[model samples]
Target chain A: MLQNVPTRQTIEAAHMLIAPYIHRTPVLTSAFLNNLSGTNLYFKPENLQKIGAFKARGGLNAILSLTKEQLRNGVTTHSSGNHAQAIAFAAAKVGAKAYIVMPENSPQVKISAVKDYGAEIIFCMNTPEERERNVQEVIARTGATFIHPFNNYEVIAGQATAAAELISDAGVRLDAIFAPVGGGGLLSGTGLSAHYFSPGTRVYAGEPEGAADAVLSFRSGKIERAPYVKTIADGLLTYLGDKTLPLIREHVADIFTVSDTEIIAAMQYLWERMKLVVEPSGAVALAALLKNREAFTGKNVGIILSGGNVDLARLPFGKEV
Target chain B: MLQNVPTRQTIEAAHMLIAPYIHRTPVLTSAFLNNLSGTNLYFKPENLQKIGAFKARGGLNAILSLTKEQLRNGVTTHSSGNHAQAIAFAAAKVGAKAYIVMPENSPQVKISAVKDYGAEIIFCMNTPEERERNVQEVIARTGATFIHPFNNYEVIAGQATAAAELISDAGVRLDAIFAPVGGGGLLSGTGLSAHYFSPGTRVYAGEPEGAADAVLSFRSGKIERAPYVKTIADGLLTYLGDKTLPLIREHVADIFTVSDTEIIAAMQYLWERMKLVVEPSGAVALAALLKNREAFTGKNVGIILSGGNVDLARLPFGKEV
Candidate 1:
């Protein structure tokens, strides 16, 4: 059951499991950007990955890692959107039933995508407790295995595969890597990769101002939770999980908080210059670089664009229903 | 003066001027899409090109084609946004001064980017005649070479080079290719490349219903003037220039029209499903495919994703500024 998983081994196994299903999305280095930031900037384009995000890698890896009996039992999860879609897609590919618990407030575009994949949708109030309870109920009713959205060793190890791919593809020793922190799955995975592949490399978590629990946690050297998150970056609203917070603290170099305005501006820059439509959460790493130019300047900075599963209608100010 | 004018030789020559300055963006093929459409689909990702559009090729080519004496005198252009920014970026790279005339109605994000690259900006009421007159005045005052945004052979030829790169990169013999038609710069170039490289490949121009002058003209077999354009696709609102229209007629296989709603829906699909942030104009070809799925079903189809430069704050509809 992978109950006593060593972080490094699980991550490595995840790379092998998901390699065939997930895209090895490109890492682009621009001379123009290097000149602008005085840094050798490497942009890992998870925006171009299948299902439009890095979460697909983890979701697929976790699904593939399941035993044949568990596959027949199906899987259930709760997410705002991206992770739900990823799990739904991955589960469907393996011919396993997927039960997705999403907030009623989730965008129709996301809901539609999840439904299109034939996942059973369970809508609940937009609260963590409500989502958790609904997921538990679904699991109990359907005899579906509960897949922790971002707090499981399997998920974190799966997410870490993105970093392993980046390090292998770029073939360069990076000074540091910046990743957006939500439930800390991505950060935890990235931190572990930096620990194993490039131990000397620093790992920084990019958090939105309104959802700075990760940053606060890093500063205090303890896990902290946000009362509620209110940010343009919908994906960064997740509170950290027990499985991720410890690994994040042990391996993460630091965390940087950026304003919503900075995230929007970074999104704009990527769209106009890089020809990418990265969501605000996906752009937070670049936002951190742009917001704190002095700190990231002239370094060999690796920025992981997390996801691009944004509701276009709600863009600019998040007003679309 | 580019005295040789709009000839195949002239367009071929522009390739040299812009080759070093712009990216030869890659083409992505999807077996899944091809099977669904009953046609092979090849996406020319000019969205991945420099300046996030095909304008970079034409813009850089026009600026670089300038004689040493002309460069010493500087360059001037009038555009709503993309062309102005393209010229500004190209001029900055070549150590030449840029004077750009833009409409007061141009998006602030576009203006900001142009200004950031150190261009001189002149604002005027948006009308084809007014913009041209203002550009002439700027040229007269500064003795700067006038780099016509669309009409010039240099720009058209430069735009053609993008198709050249695409054909070379994808290495697939396509039965037909689709590109958005506005000023016809892209169409002219794409037509020329098909004429030169893949003679059997038919070039189809896609335009918005709100701004479909090119389709009308192509059908009538003449240069039809557009009195006005009121479409969500800001870039495709341009009237056909005298120089580009003739080339389009000679080389184009057909012109297809799509609605603003279609363009928006296609943009949403590309961003959410394909994970690319294609602008309304860029989405036109994909829109054409989605709308007329029956015609393209099970055929080899090539589409130019012209650009990805949308400001999330100013998404054509739904998004509130």
Candidate 2:
């Protein structure tokens, strides 16, 4: 069933609830990037957000909105990315136990960050069925509420605030705003905010060619898995959620699919030119904008840099052709 | 003869003169860093400045302060670093030709940046005598006015504005301000600004142990060269100038020498936590502060990150043992 889409008022409430916990991340601009892309780009750096991703907003909101009984038990989620850190951080804030299940092969950096947040980790096999089974076991054992990374209503409401801020803060009207689509949490939230707040501002999604499920879903008006999932954008490997898909289909103007090489090159531009330590997923929106520059030329563009949690030792810069 | 120190009014004027040409550069802080270091650090990221360094402030001030006839003849400088790109960018802004004398083995990233700014490159052997000879040749051929990298009065005035801005913008009064010393242009300027603008705020300098001349000069009451200079802080290889030493002795509280290991570690913290892409030279002051965290335990500290122009292909992160 498609969940009821959040009202603009619900997002405003979520913004107030999470404001003290999350950073009012700066909207950064680059003249060099603007000149290169032939568009004025306003980058809202969520990489500088707590837990180094936009996941902080949703995670904080979801945990903060939980009932006292729910808090008494704890919160649990299964992930191997920024969402895990976000959940751990948010749970710790409320003095609740956070039990996070993760893929056995998660990056050491990410595992260490979640552990640092005092989250109890339960390793699972790297598959949807295995992750679900592990989460069910954790919930059954601890009586903890499972916080869905994106599909939850409160989490979607929380994610909406980032775009609401941009729409309200950007001095001029942006022609379009682009964000990377993973589980469609951020992209769906961004689409909804842009639709309700500034109806004229079109929302766009940048899906990795390796994880091209969102593009298929957008075209077919339903959730569809990619032909194959193999991209450097680790944060964006998930297909769109059922709740997120309908909102995306309604609000997103288009979804652009970019290659891994394009994502790495865009990451390099952000690292070298803008001095931002963005992850591959954080750079996908920018890669999308640059790849199809003609469509955005001379337009005031808003590119939401999603995260900055890459293993610095293994930067894909040397892979640049 | 000791050079007359620039008054606060001179720095104010430099701030106004170069306001259009340079980024005011944000004062950023990380709670994670504050908790780890046991002190509050306000980072002025001049790495985001035009030409990607604080040298833009000095170079632009020097060129803009020049007479029309001087600009008509053009400008020249010797640097294999940010200063080369700064002079090139500054001269290009004023429609004057810039002749930069750089070592033959200068990094291609910096070389290409200078070239991108339309500067005429004259390569010299990696020796002080050869560099001087090349600058002289450039001056003899182009009839360009030689803009000394750090030892000039106007350059010092220009560099002072960064600290002046930090003091004015930081809301809370900084207990102390720290900057890395190369030829002491930025340090002397910072010292003079702090002494005049906020008399209670102490000034300190961070010098690479590999290029530890400033510490000796501070003690001996005269300029001195390092016993043997070798450090990854490539921007801080030069000793203090006659023009800069007197101001340092008058205004600076002390100089701290740090190893390359400390510099890289501090840089890693900035990259991972604060998400700033700082170069080795830029991280030196923070290294000094971190190495001596106890002394600044409760103090509000101001750290000037000088530059962020680094070769991405050759990041020294692997040497972090």
Question: Clashing residue pairs, candidate 1?
Answer: A38-A298, B37-B297, B37-B298, B38-B297, B38-B298, B38-B299, B39-B298, B39-B299, B40-B299
Q: What is the DockQ of candidate 1?
A: 0.39
lDDT of 1 by residue, A120-236 (tens): 999999987999899889978888988877887778888998887777767678988889999899998999898998888899888998998888777676678764568989888
Model 1 TM-score?
0.86
CAPRI tier of model 1:
acceptable
* All candidates: TM-score: 0.86, 0.96
lDDT of 1: 0.81
Worst 10 residues of 2 chain B by lDDT: B312-321
